[model samples]
Target: MKNVSRVFYITLALVIITVIFGAAFPAQFEGITGSIKSYVATTFGWYYLLLMSALVIVAVSISISPWGKIRLGKDGEKPEFSLPTWTAMLFSAGMGIGLVFYGAAEPLFHYLSDSPTAETGSGKAFKEGLVYAYYHWGIHVWAMYGVTALALAFFQFRKGEPGLISTTLKPLFGDKMNGPLGTLIDVLAVFATVFGVATSLGFGAVQINGGLSHLFDVEVGFTSQFFIITVVTLLFLVSAWTGLSKGIKYLSNTNLVLSVVLLVLVLIIGPTILILNMFTETFGMYIQNFIEISFRTAPLESDNRSWLDSWTIFYWAWWVSWAPFVGMFIARVSRGRTIRQFLTGVLTIPTLLVSIWFAVFGTTSGNIQNNGTELTQYATELVLFNMFDQLPLSLILSLLAIVLIGSFFITSADSATFVLGMQSTNGSLLPANRIKIVWGLAQSSVALILLYVGGLQAIQNTIIAAALPFSFVMILMVIALFKALNEEHKKMEAEEEKKQNS
Candidate 1:
C-alpha cells in the first residue's frame, strides 16, 4: 500500500466505475462498447494493420542490426533463466490460453463460416483458412509483443529505468514522463493490461465451462463461467502470493509440459498426416502471401472488409492491448540478454511453436468437418471439446484439454497480477502480496462482468476500444527505443575511439 502510486488508485477507481456501469446496466454497457468498437474498427482498421505490420519489420530489423550487440543489462550479466525455461515462459505467457481456445475454432470459423478470400467450404477456402489462421497468430503477433518487450527490457535494464510503460518514453520526453501525463500513460497501459488479460480469462473460463459441459453435462452459461472464474482466480491468487520465481515459473513449466502433451496427442490421434501436411503447406503459403495479407484493407470488397474487421483487425488490437502485460512480464525475466538474443527468441521461436499448434488443431478440426462431423453446429467454446470427442482417447484428451486450459488460465492470471502489482506500485521487482490479491480479484471481476454482458462479443468490443490508444503508445515507444539505442551506440563508439587514442 505504501508503494502504491496514484496509478493504482486511479486505475482501481476507473475499473470500479466500469464494473458498476457494466453491472447496473449490462445492455447499455454492451451497446455503448459495441458502438465504439465498431467505430474504431471501421475508422482505424487500416491503422491497426499498418502499425502491427511495421512493428514486425522494426523488431526484425533491430535484432540483426549492429545495435543487436548491446546487452539488456550491464555488460556480461547472465540470463536469469535457461534457454528451455525461457522459451517455455515465453510461449506460455505469450500464447498459452489462445493456443487452446482458438487453435481449432479459428480455422473452423474461417473455413466454414467466412473465408477471407475464398468461398466458404471450398478447397481454396480450406487452405486459405489455415493460412490466415497462421497469419493472425504468426510472426506478426510476436513482432508486436517482441518490439514492446524489447523496448521495455532495453530501458528498464540497460538504462536503469523503472519497468513501466511511461518510463520507456523518457528518452523522448525526459522529465516530462514523470508528470501527470506519465501517470496517464501508465494508467492506459494498466487499463489495457487489465481488460486485455480479462478477455483471455473470459475465453479460458468459457472453454473450461464448455469442456465441463461436454464431460459432465454442467450447464454452459454465465453462471458456470462466473464460478469458473472465481475458482480459478483463487487458485492463481494463491500462486501470486507465493511469488513469481517459484509459482509462475514452475506453473509456466507445467503449462509447457501439458501443452506439449496435448499437442502431441492431437497430432498423433487426430489426422496426423493432415496436420503435418497443413503445417508444411500453410506456413509456406503464409509466408508467400504475408505482404498482401498484412496490408490488405479490403476497401473494395465490403464482405472481405467485414471479415477483416471481425478477425484480423480485432487480433491486431487485442495483441496491442495485451502487449503491456506480456511485454513487461517478458522484460522482467529477460534481464541480462543481448537485444539480438531477446528479440530473436521472442520473435522466432514462439511464432514457430504456436504456428505448429495452430496447424495441428486447425487442420484436425477441418479434417473432422470434412469427414462429416458437422462441427459447425457446436458453439465456438465447445468446438475443441466436440472435436476431441470424435478422436481416440476422447475422454482423456478432453480432460487433458480442460486441465491444460485451467493451467493456462491460472498461470496467465497469476502473471497478470504480478505485472499489475508492479505497474500500480513503483515497478517493484517484488510487489506486495496484498496488492497482487486486489488485482487478481479485479481482473476476474472484470472478466466476469464482460462475460455477463455479451459473452465473447463484449470481450472483443472492449479489446478493440482499449487497444486504439495503446497502439499510438507503441509507435512512440519504437521511436524512443531507436533514439536511445542509437545514442548509446554512438557513445560507446566515441569511448572506444578515445581509449585507442590514449
Candidate 2:
C-alpha cells in the first residue's frame, strides 16, 4: 500500500509540475487542457448528469434502509453528539463555501436563463431560476456526500477497515482492492479532491479579493488573489493543527452563527414580499416538474440542450469533483449516526436553509439586476460587489458579507486539510501533526498556483475534468452500497432464524 501510494504521488507531482510550467507560458497550457475540458463537456456532459441523478437515488435508498441503521461504534460504544448538534455540524461542514457562492448567484442565473422547463420563456424566469437553483443545489447533491461518507464511516469505525473508499468497497471487491486496486481508488480520490477543492479556494480567494477591492476601490488582480490565499491558508492550517475538537469545532460554530446572521440581515434589508413570493413560486415549479427536471435528457439537437448543459451538467461534474473530500469529512464526523439520521441531515436540512438563503439573497440580488441598479451596469467581476455595495446597509452589510465568505472558505479548507491528513496517514482520524501541516501547506500552494493560472473558471474546469474518471468509481460505490445492504439483511434474517430455532 505504501509503495503504491508513493508511486502515485510521484507521478502526480510530475504531472502537476508539468501542468504548472506548461501553464507558466500562457498560450501553451490553454490550448492543451482547455481544449480537453471543452471536448469532454461537449461529449459526455449529459451522461454525467444522469450518473449524478442515479447516484442520488441510490444514496437516498441506502439512507432509508435497515443496514443504514448500523452505528459506527463497537457493540457497547456510544454516540458523540446529540442528534441536532451532529446534524448541524454535518450539514455545515458538508456544505461549506458552496452556500455562499451559489446561494445568491445560481438561482438568479437560472432565473435569467431558462431551465429544463421553460427553455424559451423570459417571463417569470427569476422565480424559475431560484427553483432551478434549489433543484440542483438541494438534497441530491448532499445525498452524494452522505452516501460516500456513510461508506467510509461504517467501514472504518464499524468494520475496522481503513477509512478510505477502498475499504468501503471491500464488501464487494473483497481483498482484490486491498492491494493495488485499493491504492488506486485512494490516489484517484485524493487527486480529484485536491484539485477540486483548490478550485473552490481559488473562487473564494477571488471573491474575497473582489469584496476587499470593492470596499477599498483597489484592483482585484493577481496580488490581491495571492494575498487572500496566504491569509486564508494560515487560518485553515491553524484550525487543522488544533484538531477537530478545538479548531474545527470552534470555526464551524462561528460559521453557523455568521451564516444565520447574514441570512437574517438579507431578509431585513431586501423586499420581503418579492423575495418570499419568488421563493414560493420557484419551489412550486420545482415540485410540479421535479421528475422531468431531474430526469431531463434533451439531446444535442433538443432546444433545452444548451440550458441543461450550462446548469445541470456543470453542477453534476462540480459535485463529483468535490465528493471525495466532502464524503470523507462527512463520514469522519458521522461516527455514530444512524443511516436515517445521516440521510435527513445531509439531504433535507441543508436544502431548506439554502433555499431560504437564495430566496432572500438571490432574490434581492436579482431585483437589483432587474431594475436599473448601478451594479448591473458593471462587468460580472464587479457585479456581485456592486450589488452588495448598493444595498441599503452597504457598508456594514458588505463587511459582514466579506466575513461570511471568508469564514465559509475557512470552514471548508480546514475540514479538507483534516481529511487529507487522515487519508495520507492510512486513515487515522488523529493523524500526525506533521502530516496535517504538509497537506495544509500543499492545499494552500495548489490554491495559489491555480489562482495565478487561468483564474477561478479554469481551475474549476480542470478539477471537474479530473473527476471524469472517478465518476465511474462512485458508480461502483453505489452498487457496493446496495450489495452491503443486502448482505446485512441476510445476516439479520439468519440470526433471527437461529434465535427462533434455539
Candidate 3:
C-alpha cells in the first residue's frame, strides 16, 4: 500500500509540474497540444465504440442463467448496501455531467438534423432522432461500467487482492502480470480516470457558471467561473472527506430526486403528446437499427456521416473516456452482487433511465424548436440557455434544473474523489479520509485551472488525449477478465477431479 501511495504521489507530482510548466510557456507546449489532439482523433475513433459494444455483450450474457453463477463474491456474506441505494449511487456516478449537458441538447440537435440511421424523407425520421439519444444513453453505456466493476469487486474482495484493477487480471495471468506489469496497468487506469473525470469537472464548472449567470443575471466571465468552482469544490471535498456510505450515497440520492423533479416539470409543462410520440418512435428506431449504428465506422468524408461522427462517435469516445472512473466507483459499491444482478441492475436499468431522460427532454426541446411560435427562433438564438425559455414553468424549472446539475456534478466528483483516493491507497476498498479529501481538492484545483484555460473544451480535450492509451487498456482488461474466469473454471474442474479420485 505504501508503494501504491508513493507511485500515485510521483504521478501526481509529474502531472502538476507538467501543467504548471505548460501554463507558464503555452507556446512551448503547442506540440504537446497537437499530439494529444491527434491521438484522440485517430486512435480513439472506432476502438472505443468496439470496446463498449463488447462490454455490453458480456454483461447481457452474464445476466442470463448459467454464467451468472460464476460471480466472484464470497459465500454467506450479505450485501452491505440495499439495492435501491446501490443502484442510485451507481447510476448517478455513471451518468455524471453528460446527462446534464446533453439531456436537453441531444434530442433537439437530432431533430434539427434528422436521424443519421434513418432513410431520408421518412416522416418517422425525426422520431428516430429522439430514439438515437435514448439508445446512446441506454444499457450499452452502463454495461461498460458493469463489466469493469464486476471484475474489480470479484477479484479484489473475494480473491483478497487489495481491490485494484491489475489484481483483477490475476485470474488469467497468474503470477506473471502481478509485478511491475500489474502496477503499470493500475497506473494507466488511474491516469485515464483522472483526466476523464477532470473533463467532467471542467464541464460541470462551466454549466454551473451558465446557470448562475441565468439565475442571477450576472455576466459570464472569470468571476462567475471562479465562484462556481469554489462552491462546487468545497461541496464535493466535504462529501469525499465524509466517506462513501454517508457522503456519496446521500449526494447521489439527492441528485436522483432533483433530476426527476426537473424532468417531470419539463414533461408536464411541455407538449406531452410530442414528447411521448417522439420517445416511442425513437426507441423503435434504435432497437431496429441497433446493430448498424452500434457498429458504424463511416469514413470522415461520407455524407450525413459527419453527423454520426459528431453525435455517435463523439459520445462513444466520451463514454470510453469516462469508463475508468465510473468502473472503479461501481466496483467499490458492488460487493456481494452476482454477475447477473450486477449486469441487469447496473447496466440495463441505468441505460433505460438515461434513454428515457434523453427521450423526454430531447423530444420536448425539439418539438418546441420545430413548431412553437416562440421556440423555433428562440432555440436558434440561444444555445445552452434554449431549454430555459421552452418551459412554461421557466423560473421554477430553472431552479430545479440548476439544482440537479449542481448535484450531479457534486455527486460524480465525490465518487471520483473516493475512487482516486482508494487507487492511491493500500488498494483497500476503503481508504483513509484525508487521502480522499486530498484527491477531491486536487480534482477541484485542476478544474479551476482548466476554467482559466478557456473553460470546458480545454479540459475535455486534455482528457480525451490522456484516454487514448487506456482505451486499449480497457480492451486488455476485458480479455484479462475472461481469461481469468476461464482459468478459475479450469482450477475448479481440476479440484473436482482430484476429489473424485481421492
The models' CA-based lDDT, in order, is 0.91, 0.72, 0.70
The TM-score, computed over Cα atoms with residue i paired to residue i, of candidate 1 is 0.99
Question: Could you tell me every candidate's TM-score relative to the true structure?
Answer: 0.99, 0.92, 0.90
Evaluate residue 150 in candidate 2 and report its C-alpha lDDT on the 0 to 100 scale.
75
Q: Give the best candidate by TM-score.
A: 1
Candidate 2 lDDT, 1-502, residue by residue in tens: 3312452464357446845664476555545657777777788877776776776777777766677666665644666766655655665566656667666666556555454555432556766777777877776787777778777777787678877777777777899876888878877887777777777777777777777788887677988888888888888887787888777777777877887887887787777888888778777777797777777777658567767666677677778888888898878777776667677677878778777877887788788777766443444445556777657777887788788778878878888877776776667778777666666666767777666666765665576578898888887887786777677668867988999999
Q: Kindly list the per-residue Cα lDDT of model 1 for residues 1-502, writing each as its tens digit.
A: 5889999999999999999999999999999999999999999998988898899899989999999999999988999999888888888788789889998999999999998889899988888988888888878999899889988888889999889999999988989989898999999999999999999999999999999999999999999898899899989998999997899999999999998999999999888887888789889998898899899899985557889999998999899988999999999989889999999988889878888988899999999999999999988888998999889899999999999999999999999999999999978888999999999999999999999999999999999999899888999999999999999899888988999999
Tell me the deviation in Å of residue 202 in model 2: 0.7
Write one digit per residue (lDDT tens) for candidate 3, span 1-502.
Answer: 3335654776577568756865676554544654675565565567767776888788777667455755557755667789878878876888757787777766655655545756642455557666677767776777877877877777776677776777766666768655777767777777667667777777776766676666787677767777877888888888777788898889888887777787787777787787777777777777897887777766556446556545665566667777778888887787777777777788667877787788777676666666653333332213335566656767777667677778888898888877887777747667777777767777776666655655544554566567666677777777877776666667767887999999
Against the true structure, candidate 3 reaches a TM-score of: 0.90
Model 1 steric clash total: 0
After superposition of all CA atoms, the RMSD between model 1 and the true structure is 1.0
After superposing candidate 2, which stretches have Cα over 4 Å from the reference? 1-8, 11-19, 75-77, 113-121, 300-304, 379-382, 496-502
Error of 1 at 360 (Å): 0.7
Better of 1 and 2 by TM-score: 1
